[model samples]
Target: MGVQTNPCLVVLAAYSLILIQANITPVLAHVINQTESPATAAPQAPPPVAPVAPVRSAMQPLQATDLLTADKPCSHGLERQMPYFGMGAPGPSGSAGIPGLPGAGGAQGARGERGDRGEPGLSGFPGSKGDKGDIGAVGPQGLVGLEGLNGTKGVKGEPGRDYTPPSMSAFHVGQSSNLQVTSGSQIISFNAQYINIGDDMSQHTGVFTCRIPGLYYFTYTFRAYSHGSYGLNIDLLVNNVVKSQIYMTAMSKHLMQTQSTIVTLRVGDDVWLKANANTYINGDDEMNVFSGYLINAI
Candidate 1:
């Protein structure tokens, strides 16, 4: 009876030993109570609550090369290569570009080679005479400065001479020295015992004829009282050179003695009084001319 011989291998060995005792001892008792049962599994629905998508504050970009590196990318707020920044984004529109063609005028620049004249700068040390300038506002007196050009006249002074004529003719008679004659021998007179017999007389002349030209002084006289008593010859010819000459000689007692010639004649002169007789005496005979004449003219 082998139990009905293999009866389904004993019900498949008792269903494999009850599924190895219900799944290997509950998978070794869940690996020995996985750290003591971390709160029993199947209530994990908290993980599906992942919809918190609002944490987005990432707009800090702009880094042209490595400008301090803070992530990078900004377009409307402009920073791709950096030239525009914007609140309204309307800021950077400035580059128009084209219309270019006018360029040929550039060649005139080559004339600069003459520069070596710089070494004369050291003569500047004479500057200290400057403080006397403020007196200039009176300028209206300028027309009088043109009168200085006249000076040349001096050399003519040497001529003034002539006055030298006087050789002799002087008369000063205070009276008396008689040559008186009358008794009708043609008018002549003088008699008072023949006054003061001429004393110291002198006369000289070459010509005479100016009857009234004022200022004349002429005189001539001769005397005698004891020399021979008498001899007389008298001559006085003016303008004819005989100025005076007289002589009386010879024991002639005294022939009316008196010899004198004086002249101060001015009005048409031609005086004539001459006596001639060598010797004779006796209170007689002629010899006349007394107080001759005198005519003064201005």
Candidate 2:
């Protein structure tokens, strides 16, 4: 018969159809690589959606004539009018606000505009020294000076008014004669008289006269003796001039002499005591003598 089929059921139905195509082959190759790629692959931006608040319908409270007709102005664009409420342009100036509280001090302002001129200062130091005062008062008186010089020359005076003082006075004479003669001049005459007080003395001629008128003072004394070779002399006159003298030679064998004088008489002066020319004389009882006195009356 042509009819006999069972080869083991045809090898177990082809082994289960190859295990069902190996388990569907990666899901059909991922759906065929997603339907053949590129439909311009750049279309995936759909995730930021947060805008949902616009459902408003509840604000209706206005009356003051509806805010004065809502201060109108917006007519043509949306075409229905009257519902304005404006007041907006002032908003940008608000950032400077927090400073307010300092206002009440205004009235002292009007005196200000005069200020520019300063720079030039530095130089100071020097002061120290004081102390010393007190002393004043005393003045006035001065003027006068000059004058001096002249002196010398003096001496000699005494004899004033009409002078007159004198009392004549006199003395004359010899005693004891041994009058050897060998002479040529003689005036030895005295017959012995002692004092002639104002009789002014004149023993014959051994004179002594002066009657007052000046200064007078006279005196004389003498004695002599010489023999073999013989020589002797004596004299003492005044008015007949020969004031005084006495001598002895032959080797002087005993001779003696004395004399004195001061004369200025003028009323008839005359005093004497003479002998000379081979003269010789020897007397004793008071020797040969003559004297006179009267001093001062000129």
Candidate 1 lDDT: 0.41
lDDT scores of the candidates, listed in order = 0.41, 0.63
Tens digits of lDDT, candidate 2, 252-297: 4777777787878777778777776676667674876666777676
Off by over 4 Å in 1: 1-170, 173-221, 225-230, 241-249, 252-256, 259-294
lDDT of 2 at 283: 67
Regions of candidate 2 where Cα sits further than 4 Å from its true position? 1-166, 175-193, 196-214, 217-226, 229-243, 248-261, 264-280, 284-287, 295-298
Minimum summed lDDT over a 10-residue window in model 1 is located at: 197-206
Q: How good is model 1 by TM-score?
A: 0.18
TM-score of each: 0.18, 0.20
